[model samples]
Target: MSLRRLLLVAIALTFSFLSSFVLATPLHIIAAENFYADVAKQVGGEYVSVSSILSNPDDNPHLFEASPTIAKSIAQAKIAIYSGIGYDSWMSKLLAGHSHLTIIDVASLIGRQDGDNPHIWYDPHTMLTFALAIKQQLIRLDPAHQASYQHNWQQFVASMHPILTDIDSLRQRYAGTEVTATEPVFGYMFAELGFKVRNLGFQMAVMNDTEPSISQMKGLHNDLIEHKVAFLLYNLQVSDPMTEQLKTLAQTHKVAIVGATETMPKGIHYQQWLKQELDAVQKVLKK
Candidate 1:
């Protein structure tokens, strides 16, 4: 046989073998938030396909409105993951028709109920719980790849050590340090760091899409101007005139500003993203 013909036959055989190996298409997963999708990708590896509806980091998830297209996507998915307890309420409404689909409500997984803080992913323990749960789900969905899923889950758990260590170091060095924010997007992380977060009324008002009372606004202003807190967490995902004003005041007063987002941003893994944010906190507080 000619040399070129032999090479072509070898390539054809290799392609056929690879095709048979993954004869089953990946399990389709739809996540209401991007962070969950990121974690799903880590645990499921190539066995599951994940799509996130709330992938945009700049938009406020609170204002998300579901479309017929979104409903169709949810209907076609084999699994749907979302943050329950009023965080991604629109996802619940859209998923009502998909009773057969395996659903993972992350908030409820950790015993969070309605009226509790919905940003549960900010807590390291919450993500760990979610990683294990998703790993189990992947194993059940594709038992053929159980070993691969287990190995990936173990790697993910190990990668979390740096994040936990950073949090612990910050907690030890800065416990009871006061802080404030335009919104409570990072409330769980702040609590993990042992911060006394001020301006609850204002934060709740913003989260609920209501105007903050004059008193609430004044209190946050004082916190910024007087440097009552070690830093101010600026929610870059959501913005209104009031929140914008607080950000400006924080800048004017020279209070340390740490910006946080609601969803995981593009082109970053879950573990690295969390570590970078924690590092930002350490850097600002060390000043």
Candidate 2:
């Protein structure tokens, strides 16, 4: 090649590198749930500015109403992390008006199947997939931080290895252990741990916002009375009269009660929240 041509190519490469280095900006990310917000923050590190729409732990995620302020947040967001499974369908309405933003639908990326539980975050393996997807999206939005994003993701995954190991250990220890849950929030996690679910129909009815029949409730009560269940997992949010009644029954019948939360409460991080959940399960199962 001619000297002038070689010099021009070198200059172009140098300018390209310099542009990427100078264009680094904090990523504006809007996450549907607090869990995704935490995961995105961990992966994006200091290069991201995150906001979550449904952050209240006391609210029912299944029946959340999106406000105008949330719509504006979505409009301003450069990237959005949403849980698709008909849980956050409002995001679709918001995205329809503003189509330029890159929205990452966790359900679509992970392949949502019929009868597939929407609580994907409870599954540790799915969280790893989410981390990789978040890393890729952040890298795409801010190529200059690609190396940093990758490094953060690697560290996050490495940190999750111990959690995965704990999950496996719990699975072996609690295999075939039967549990009854009022809400289906922990269905995926319990299933992963090889625990037998006693009231699947009841849980599904509650999850879909339908009322369970008297016979189903009676059967559940009988199961508790018969000592067929080892634990009674209940949602910390929502005051279901039936669930409250069942809680009393569980107390009377000596069935251990385990409270699970769909959203992390204030002042607790992701790791701490998950550790508390697992510890609750361990304590319930041991008794």
Best by lDDT: 1
Q: Write the per-residue lDDT of candidate 2 for residues 179-203, one digit (tens) a residue.
A: 8889788988887899989888888
Clashing pairs in 1: none
RMSD of each: 5.0, 7.9
Score candidate 2 by TM-score against the native: 0.89
Minimum summed lDDT over a 10-residue window in model 1 is located at 235-244
Off by over 4 Å in 1: 1-23
Worst 10 residues of 2 by lDDT: 19-28
What is the number of backbone collisions in each predicted candidate, taken in the order shown? 0, 0
Once fitted onto the true fold, the runs of candidate 2 whose alpha carbons sit more than 4 angstroms away are 1-25
TM-score of each: 0.90, 0.89
RMSD of candidate 1 to the true fold? 5.0
Question: Largest TM-score belongs to which candidate?
Answer: 1
Summarize candidate 1's per-residue lDDT along 1-287 as a digit string, tens digits: 99999999999999998898667668889999888999889989988888989888876788888778878878768889998899888987888868878999999899999988788999989999999999998888789999999999999999999999999999999999999988878999999999999998898888888888999989999999998988889877766677678778988999988888778889998888898899888999899
